[model samples]
Target chain A: MENSPKIAANPEKYTFILFVSGMSVKSGHAIENLRSICDTYLKGNFNLQIIDITTDRQSAVDYQIIAIPTLIKTGPGQPRTLLGDLSDTEKVLRILDIKS
Target chain B: MFNYFHKKNQTGVRKIKPSKPQDEKFSFPKTPTGVEGLDEITDGGFPKGRPTLICGGAGCGKTLLSMQFLIKGITDFSEHGVFMSFEEPSKDLSLNVKSLGFDLDKLKAEKKLVVDYVRVERSEIEETGEYDLEGLFIRLNHAIDSVNAKRVVLDTIESLFAGLDNQAILRAELRRLFHWLKEKGVTAIITGERGEATLTRQGLEEYVSDCVIILDHRVIEQVSTRRLRIIKYRGSTHGTNEYPFLIDEDGISVLPITSLKLNNEVSSELVSTGVPGLDTMFVGGGFYRGSNILISGTAGTAKTTIACYFANEQCKKHEKTVFFAFEESPQQLIRNMKSIGIDLEKHIDKGLLQIHASRPSLNGLELHLLTLRKLIKDFKPTTVILDPISNLITVGNENEVRSMLVRLIDMLKANNITALFTSLNKQNDNLRPDLAEESVSSLVDTWITVRDMEGIGERNRGIFIVKSRGMGHSNQVREFVIGSKGIELLDVEFGPEGILTGAARKSNQLQRTVKAMKLQSDLDRKDREIDRKRKVLEANIAALKNEFESVVEELGILKATEDLHSKIMIENTPKTKKK
Candidate 1:
């Protein structure tokens, strides 16, 4: 588990950072929607990091996440930011440049 | 970095506990703008730890106002501030405000200020994917943290819109930016270009900021004036009128002239009207110390002369006076007063009197009031005189003039300064039907009417105390003469036709002298006739007495002759018969 074969094999996997307000309705919706989209589309090809802005304000400031439910594609060719709840799976996939 | 965040979070938790009560209504404490006459209109200042939008057209002093706010915050309240410009560079901004006497370079060197210039060029960059304004946030955060700023100004943030192509993203980012500033606990001023139908070009007022101020510059009758109005202030009450603001070498100053209330302290001390006879009209020596006196009359009725006398009297009492001459220049007024023996130049030379002469048409009514207010504040005069306030009627309507005079009088009363205004009435306006006079008459504590009494081939000036509030005043219409010795009220004259004056008085005196001479001659002739009659009657009485004496002598002689002829008995009988 600590050194999984997929993580070890994919050296240039997609890196994602999801910023959310703690336990909010919008944040909960965004987390569920993003998980289904990433799990179904990226399979075992992405690395995701979830940060709660209430607890990790420094990381939020570092990433410059102003609004809640912000998703950052850090490992992509160029960094892309998507705002609002990630309820639209097709739009999120296109914004993240991922294929199912 | 993780540990630093943990430490900061701990301190933040502690800070949040104490600030919870302030969050009930989300009522942010205010930060004083420190601009003259601005905080009064804003009811303290802009909201603290929140964004304030200042929108105006080009060259309306939006940047200057914001700069003054930031600089004054640092200098007056000891609160550090940061100015981030998206339009002009820091060097140009510093130079621009240098004329206003703001030493931005020195303040920066002292670590109390930071001016950051953010340059955005659309042609230099291409947008491909979704992104945030991280660069701007980082720059602003770094600048604020370096100076520990409590205030911030983003002058003309709409320039970013001009330089950026993504409107949806910029709008979202700006909303979040304002929230971010609130979270950072810094008072921020965001300036923008005014839109056709919105408060800002980007409709930034939709973001729900704490305050919104709109500046308007307009040219009326070939005179440009800048007016400021607070469209909205969330948590505090503010003045609602459009206040005229002026930008001079000292920066922007708003004149909240009508914001003053009528509850200022009043004085009971009396101040003479300078003309001794006029002072005798009031129950007190003259008007109340802080009272407003209006002298209304037609042209050449000595209205300015009376105002000059009042000002001269104040100066004579060692009290400072400010005389606003709207009709005549200072030198011209001095020359005219000299003819009436009012030496105003003497007081001016002694620094006890300040003469501010200007044409009423030079600017709008508000500008005139503002100039007067500035002069009064700087001179700290105990008395103020506005000669021919009627001239101001040309600049504004009746309502505007009334409100302006009300404010002027209220300010003088608040400062415990005596004020006298001379108004010109129309020719033959004996009923005092002038609109300006009618409007301000109720606001004055004393009202005097001077008119021309044209009768019997001569025109004489008559002064009457129309009303004196809270005191008894003379009701007699005293005819006054303006000569080399100033104004002197003549004694009341009475004739069959009523109060006599001019030629009628002279003719009445002549008629009285003729009647007295005719009465003296008639009495002397009657005395001579009575003396002649008494002399004739005395002569007749004397003559009768002589006859009686002679008859008695004859009777005595006949009795002696009869006594020789033995007629002693007959003589005794004749004597008995005579008895």
Candidate 2:
């Protein structure tokens, strides 16, 4: 028998608002990274709403997010912010203190 | 081994592409499943450009996992998916997951996904020689192209084997089917029935596949463990252990507990155990949030009470709760519990609780599981209760309930929701619920037992903590009494007599017999008090008699003095003074 994966569903309320600049390398990586983080780290209690500058570049400025791959914790806790592509699972999971 | 890049968009269209091509790069593309533990087990997700086999025994969470993977892909990854089921109808799947809040039908209508259910009955079709899954391929391609799909799922393709008797032709066709799917170059999940000698009966899938995930449900002693393992994954470093998996309303969850990594970071706050006495027994005085508790007891021993107490505790906390009453009717159960003072009416009215009571006989074991799964999916309760899953024996006997409980546990654990369950044991001498029969005990993080121990000429209902996975707990059976204040537990009285019972109990009834038995000190005090009262009465009588005698003497003196002449005046005066 193979060992099982440690999978858990999150209970805290959370949503993510992403500010991306166009569908560039960083933008695509950011979306994938955010999704992967949510899948492996956040499970289902979190949602991600993306603002793509590909068509609506002005909308990114409205959120005042200076970085291209900025993640805003929209719903839960004190305003937690993560900058850069969400490729770091451990850091992201730690920042959120996700239930292990 | 996968790299994804977004397309440079001139207008509004979004393009999704993988950095590594199928043949040019040996690195396998991964389809990340949005489910927590599943991605870890698969080392990312299902194989990106090949058919991943998910073979399992009946009621082993095959369909659910595939659906979860598909839904996660479409909604999270922007990779449109096509769900082609060979067993269940699209309507049933939609209805089943409606509780989970996944509107697959809506996803299909949105042109982002496709749900096609193909019905095949062996009795209906007669096959000659050559057979092809060409129709399924065409339908799948159409659905995929419509959404520019990246994911596809075929549930229980073994239906084709049972439908067609030409074993050689079916085997050949099954091989061809996987080949064609691989040619499609889209991540696909193919569910199959467990074969007697292998992961799949056809045996062709494991021979030529990018990945093979096997799901199994088995009873080890009395505990049923539903395990999922990566039998083979060609190009990825996948977890090799047989991970325990659960299928509930929110779908399949594989708990990858490879170690005893304890986290004291548990919520320091306490939540009541529903039973006042039980909560008081805890040092923190309650169970932590997301705790899994088991109440095991013989029939008529109030396992249901413990569950009710747990639910009541949650309602008191002002948290929403979902009660899956598989044994009793909501009204019948509520009315019966009124005798014990468990008033669920107010909680239901307050919108803090939802009671979903149903007869296990109403559906097959899977349907019942699906319904519970749906309830949790839709209700999203902080706590869930299953009253006497032992009654679920009517649905699938032992094997089915065990499997169902395994899934049920996984679902609750994954959601971080506290779950309370009551399991009935028919035999008095059993240590646990016919756990072998139901096989659910081992999966619980905590176990509580309630039993009717013959004592005090009646029955002494006692509840004891058998085990707790993490926190330290007491191992004493406290006397459980149902009062207006809810269930109260009496302190466990320990002495040389062990547990008091029957005539011994009667003899030790000091409160009732104290008046009957006169103690020496009390008797002595009563005698002294009586003696003192008698002496005082005697003294008073004697004084009255003396006074009367003195008066008579004085009168006699006065008469004598009067007879002797006026000289008696002095004597009369003297006699009067004496009187």
Candidate 3:
């Protein structure tokens, strides 16, 4: 409804957190880039929790994320899950059900 | 309200069928601003044929940049342009830009450019019941069509905003204006005075949100420097840097401070900076032809002397060179350097070196860079010298100076030209001044500092290499001397005390005190002479007083004799008065 350049006025719906390993040579780049995309598109709506499983192997198991690189939608009502580094935004959007 | 409801009820309504949404693609020609740094930052000139919303504060070079944008499009890009001025007339625009070598009126006559001045004086017109901007639109269209304009600039929209006050009509007209620009499919610039964080006074950000560029002219430390920043571009990959820009007789040329590249390839060819001793400091005894050397020191600390020696070396090496003197004129500089035996005149005569001396204040920093750009392009010299770049900071702020240096260094490096810069530091306690221009220091391949060291009885000049990137250079601070023959690199004098600063002459008071004591002894003899003169004056005063008393006594006796005579006469007169 609001038309300011910063038009994402609604932030209460989603809390998405993205976890990252660090800016390393291999796996870190994927995590870092994914963080920027989430921040840019989701803005305040989605909080990105990027847990670096490369460092803390226990956290992945603790969150029941068995896959090495996995994204678990921890919100209520049929929490859809996805695998891989979240590179493909379309597939990620389908998994997260983000409106265009 | 009841009458409207009854009328609607009497009419009754039927739902119309919904139409399918259509996706229509349209293409618009984009006209690049051609404002130097702007095009680089925006990544290849602004989208040609699209209207860019350039808004910023007053005195931010809005009108000037817009005009330059149009002028460059005409002159450089071979594109036709239409300039619609809401501020000044066509004559003023031409006059104002004539200094820039942009013959606006000539271009107009040549049918390459067209300018229409919409003198929107509020007093000239009477308001009608319902009006439109068709007249203004027609005028703009006529101007555009006449030139077959590929570029158009609306100097300012606020002038019309002030002339008209009907909010509804103004809003509708402004929207129509932007849409009409897109409809024309011509690249255009609609400049507005920025209000708050919004794009324009009318809040046209949402309306023309396709692209936004902001121009800012800030006076940091009393020096006005311009910077252009791109806020948004709908579909473009652009560098986001608030780059320093300059306005001069030419036009707005921005200094692209940081180009995104990390190619640090060191050249193999050893180029001497004309000074053999200084060259010996580097491991290779020279610099990569394009290396930047910073010779910094306090006044008379030999910053310029060191740089002259370097320039002299290049000429000796038979390299074609240009020295951009920021401080002294060519003749004066040559004379001073001649005293030190650098003899730049020889190089000038040989046509091996070119001395282009100018006051940094003569033009803005970017203009200086641009003139350098032009000179470099034409001369294609292998070596260049910016004698005392610190002077540039006076015309522009520190940041501007730094950015200018960055771009200059990049240009020199990209061309593989050896560059030397002299800096006169003011009362710097630290070996380095802010060298906030230090940001460019990293970009430089070599950093040299000439400082004054205090020896026991005198000050000696010392030159040291602070850093030379990708090459091993001398770490030792070598004492140096400038003499009639030329500059000689004195070995670093090592004693119990570390180093003596140069120009420490006449600093010790021991010799001064000895001279003062000798003067005091001479003054003591003068004091005796003053005493004799005081006694003589006292004696003369005493003698004159005694003489005066004696004369008084003599006068008293004479008065007694006169009184006796007067008494006799008075007795005789008194008898007559009684009758």
Instruction: Score candidate 3 by TM-score against the native.
Output: 0.62
lDDT of each structure? 0.82, 0.70, 0.70
**Candidate 2 lDDT tens digits, B1-579:** 011112113111311123235467545568897775788777678777788888888988888888888888888888889888878888999997778778998898888888877666545333221223433444565667768888889887777777656566556656666777878888888888888898788766666566888888876444455778888876567789776666555667666643233332344446788776786666567776787787887777778877887887789879889888877888977887787888888999999888888876665555565566666787788898887677777656575567667766666766678888887777656453475324866777678888888754587688888777666777677777777656777765544567543344445555336744666668888999999998998998999999999999999999987778866666668876887
TM-score of each: 0.73, 0.51, 0.62
What ordering of candidates by TM-score runs from best to worst? Answer: 1, 3, 2
Q: Name the DockQ score for candidate 3.
A: 0.01
Chain B alone, TM-score of each model?
Answer: 0.83, 0.58, 0.72
The better candidate by TM-score, 1 or 3, is 1
- lDDT score for residue B70 of model 3: 82
Model 1, residue A49: distance off in Å is 28
- Please give the lDDT score at residue B67 for candidate 3: 85
CA deviation > 4 Å runs, candidate 1: A1-100, B1-28, B123-125, B257-260, B428-432, B515-579
Candidate 1: tens digits of C-alpha lDDT, residues A1-100: 3334544564678888887767877778878887887667666778889987666655655665545677878875667777667877777767676644
Candidate 2 runs further than 4 Å off: A1-100, B1-27, B33-41, B51-75, B80-209, B212-231, B238-265, B274-284, B360-378, B392-416, B429-447, B455-457, B464-507, B510-579
Question: Which residue pairs of candidate 1 clash?
Answer: none
